[model samples]
Target: MKEAIMIDLDGFYLEPVLVSIGAYGITPIYEKPEPPESEEADEAPELPEPILIGYRVAVPVPSGLFKPRYDLTTWKAALSAYDDAMDAYCAALAAYDPDSEDEPSQPPLQVDLRAFWIEGLTRQEIDNIRNAPSPKTDQQEIARLEQQSTISMLAITELFEMMLPIIMPEE
Candidate 1:
């Protein structure tokens, strides 16, 4: 069965009066207004009506639907873990060799994170890395750095396990 859906639009140059079924196509329709009558000969010409020349539309699509969907805890953990891993990985790279003739390429995590919003790490931490701050210590600080890396790695592993088979057939 098919359903007819109606949407009201505002602030448009052309309005959609009717849309075709199935394909859902619409054409622009504009209303013409009568000229204003002038009482005084010195009256200024009526301002041109704002033309409906162009329009923009936004559509939202659901990512997916699943049984036993991810809850708050799962989402939070995955986000935190991803962020933590990114932080540790970037930190390790930064401490490797800052002044060396060969500069290391930035990881996909860091490059993508800067473009999009994600959880984990404070704004200061992200900024510190983004701004190219000097590495405070050398490779000797491996233990402390390794601890964070370990935690991030384990967290990511747990997240992957949760995603392995997200849903099962109803028993």
Candidate 2:
């Protein structure tokens, strides 16, 4: 009777029916006795300990999440700047008179709050923020600013989530 033994090559596992065949640069280990089957058929089967072959190099998995370029302190400063910009913007808008016949000496600067907190913004995100149309009315502008604030908060949250693995890794 032939017995199968599991082999681990890098991170992949391979099981072979015959153990007589030998390959260069490979090591085969005999598996331990199988555990007794449980009464529950739905339970997962126990896998045998894999025989390791060749040197195993650690490969980092891609998170696919945005990595913040700035540290926490810089991000905090950016958030503060964003808040100040929003306040100044809202105040200016509140005092604006749409029906006024005389034009104001100086118009408020249309600053994008995202500019202040662009720690994790991609090129596309930055372009979208920069290319967004200016709101025709003060009310619309305020709404737009509020929406941007929400996006900023979500970005911050994503940044925190991305950092979690580094902060506390699994055992």
Candidate 3:
């Protein structure tokens, strides 16, 4: 069976994001092998039908646990799969209702979405807001973020150029 999938920017950047069994990949086993008939005919049990639900993602983890592999099973990471998802879910909630000062109606993300979802954002959200109806508060917020992002990027680029040597490559 085929399913529609979305590729959103979660800062994976060409790296695999470790996903839980149900949360990520799941190869389907259509049928199980038949059981043995007589006392000795060896045969495997019948299997259940399943579908590869999602992508097999890997989470880039800090080095240390069990010989420094690039992935982690713990939830310690700020951008851990579950945490990242929760953050997005929270953002959706916030965007839906930014007025509630009551502690976010959800837990504060270990890290802010504003930082991670920007480029994935920067340009898209601007028009999205303008096209939205009413006072369009969310749209306005997106516009402000867009400007702040541009300024921030320019300042950073300038700082880097001034602080470091600029070398032009020979043709």
Candidate 4:
């Protein structure tokens, strides 16, 4: 005779919250359109929704699923397993910044995802691991991304780090 088998793995994990901004400020050079004859000139466009999604960001796999079948290892066999739900969790996060650019020509405040892992894994290591879907990325690229995601309203240093050279207008 045979018996049934089931298992459960539970744990709390931190998700990345992308606080994003455009890399290069997009500038539009549109000429002012002709105004209506009777309507006011400076009336602003009426917006219906207060919030909008600017972009979709992909989330990195968590350390929980980093290895396969940890319980089967020689270490311990108390039926304890890594948080298996993280796969689905990460999948849901895959479409992080799924919003279209409002003005492709102008810089916009973008909503991006940055995972704050409950575990101690750093952004660099997570970026390097190769997965079935995407190829491996180097640490520098990961670092570059880290810099891009560090946009904070309270951090003035972030602006200075962007330090783009300015060209004086021709006399």
Candidate 5:
């Protein structure tokens, strides 16, 4: 398996904003082997203790080589992974939709076809607003809010899926 993957970010970089992809390292934690079972004279054989293997797995990024590594199981590591992925995903979204009200604090980038998906959803929402009648009842309002939340959650899932390759360094 390859250790590091390089990526080009020449067009994606914006002034005062450094978004570079490089080699990410993944720390390996081996699973414990199950104990062996034996039956002889109604006695079980003793199993040897499991061994833990620790090694660094290098990951390829879009830009160049980066040295940051993380353990996936810990809370801190999980949060860091989330933050990094979200940062890149948000940047990509903002670069794609400069006029979006939910833009991140970053400069825009050149036209990227992948960034326009959220914009499509926005357009759909606009069309829905223009065509659908306003909800008059409280139950309808609650249902609308629930639907909005579900849509937002799905958007988040989409973003996460888009960044999964870069976020997850696991084999």
Candidate 6:
């Protein structure tokens, strides 16, 4: 007896399977047929049954169905912006002076900074800056910049996560 199986091709396995389908634009589903029940089945020398292996259905998969949700251009830009922000923050840190009474200039941050802060300055570095007897204004400015740098880093991380499906599909 042959059974009809309906496969759902729209779930997590879609992209990787679709990619394997290639230019022919169709995916094939195959099933092994059940063997006939016979009293001599155990006594007869088993011959490989060709009929049990050949049944399959060609499933049409539209190329457009696999389009990526995230834009590659935007992902690259986010990474670049994060790199720039980190560079600026590092430059500002190297130039910092504990004795200077003047307000430390704010480092230029990329306009695209919008995300949760992940990691950046070490705890020791933050403690040294915040615990110092520097003016409240200077402490606040440095803290704000640090926050921006961390947030930018997190934004890039998020973009990469969003692009992972396209970059490395699960097998």
In terms of TM-score, the best-performing candidate is: 6
Runs of candidate 1 with Cα error greater than 4 angstroms are 1-70, 99-105, 108-171
Please list the residue runs of candidate 3 whose C-alpha ends up more than 4 Å from where it truly belongs after superposition.
1-136, 166-171
lDDT of each: 0.46, 0.51, 0.44, 0.35, 0.47, 0.49
Q: For candidate 5, lDDT tens digit of each residue in 11-115? A: 111112122345334333355777777757588777776554543334322332122222223423455666777778776865775566774555334322222
Candidate 6, after superposition: displacement of residue 168 in Å?
81
Tell me how far the alpha carbon of residue 104 in candidate 3 is from the true structure, in angstroms, after superposition: 73
- What's the TM-score of each model vs. the native? 0.22, 0.21, 0.18, 0.14, 0.21, 0.24
Q: Total clashes, candidate 2?
A: 0
What does candidate 6's lDDT look like per residue over 12-101, in tens digits? 121232233323212234454555556775676454454322212223323332221222244357767878888888888789896998
Model 2 reaches what TM-score against the true structure?
A: 0.21
lDDT computed for candidate 2: 0.51
Pairs that collide in candidate 1 are 13-52
Candidate 4: Cα lDDT at 107? 28
| Candidate 4 residue-wise lDDT, 1-171, digit = tens | 221111112122223333234322111123344543546658765434333212122333344654322121221222122233444445555645558544223222222222222333455665667433664479878987778667554376655555533434346
Q: Highest lDDT: give the candidate number.
A: 2
- For each of the candidates, give the backbone clash count: 1, 0, 10, 14, 6, 0
Choose 2 or 3, whichever is better by TM-score.
2
Stretches off by above 4 angstroms in model 6 are 1-68, 103-171
Residue by residue across 1-171, what tens digits does model 1's lDDT show? 232222223322222233334432122234456667778889876855754433221211123211111122443455578788888778879787867887675653422211221233456766766798566676747877998999999999999878767755345
